[model samples]
Target: MKAISLLGVGICGGALIAAGCRKTNFVDKMAFKSAINNYYSTRQDCVWPSPVKFPVQADTSNYEQTKGYDALTDTGFLVRKAAEKKRFLIGSKQVNDYDLSDKGRSSWTAEQTQPGYGNFCFGHREVTTIDGFSPADVSDATQYSVSYHYDVAGVPGWASTVEMKTAFPGVAMDMSGQQSAVANVVKSDSGWQVNSVTPTD
Candidate 1:
């Protein structure tokens, strides 16, 4: 009876040790979502000038482009000047030229790597869902491709204006619903790290 009691106690202790040593799932949708959100939280949504020049010119015929500048002008971020310039195979046409206003220059987010090039930043992005990811052993895989959706957060009143929304499709889509995006995450000592996030059509 003494030997049987000792054997029973040993079996119970072994079972408890096995349960305690169960492997943990470190990589999952929640982990990826957190990593993606962390990546965007430090970034800004910036719209770069298409022409990359001061006094950017836009032909009045292009309603979308002209309206975009008009919206910015209304927001006090741009100054529009009228001009008449010759067009190919046509008479001189009235054009609208734009340059950054004092407020625009103050709010511009200049690119550190490229001098004399900057953008008007509106807001930051936040992850809403982690749609899916590549299947691999969490412990063995060095990288994973994660598909997700996100929305722009903290959008300013100017960006949400009807004119701005109509002019910039990106702003409209970002504000209307979640936008699809893909991110590459790599394993590191600190856990999953998002390397890059790119918007998907």
Candidate 2:
């Protein structure tokens, strides 16, 4: 079984776990599932409204070696490095996902910033979680759900949150402005890399 150390999600404890039926001993851990949502975006295309402090290459001009990455631009640079090979694009279609409550959100905010993600995202209609892997594997999968987190080496902007906006027009109204999308991730030398946040084709 492969093991992974989560860079984001600065919670208490040595580590967390979320195994499937094969290892059904659900602890007070966390996980993610999917659904169409109207959160974290500005465009009506299920794409995140590339934040004003969007993570990118330009932000790494003078990475204060002292701060060790304690600013918005630092984070943008890190995300850019992780996503070096991709752009926002959905890799899978089958609806599936995850999310945290206001309280949970508070938990992450209070203690951690940028809930680091290896793959899994807390909320979305298309990003699904794969189950039944080993404890290490399962935990690794759940850890991936979070997008960014503090304490994770090389990961910046650990204290940022994505605002919600919608995409996908009139086919169904009422849930306007809300947004959701499939998170595209790539395998990296260090680990998984997420780049493009694309939509269904």
Give the number of the best model, judged by lDDT.
Answer: 1
The whole-model lDDT of each prediction reads 0.81, 0.27
lDDT of 1 at 125: 84
lDDT value, residue 145 of candidate 1: 93
Tens digit per residue, CA lDDT, model 1, 1-201: 999999999998899897885566566678888888788888887554342546689988888668878988999999999999897888898899899999988977777776776777888888887787876445457889999888888887888888887787777887766689889998899978998878796
TM-score of each: 0.75, 0.17
Candidate 1: Cα lDDT at 76: 95
Superposed Cα deviation of residue 62, candidate 2 (Å)? 51
Task: Tell me the TM-score of model 2.
Answer: 0.17
Candidate 1: C-alpha lDDT: 0.81
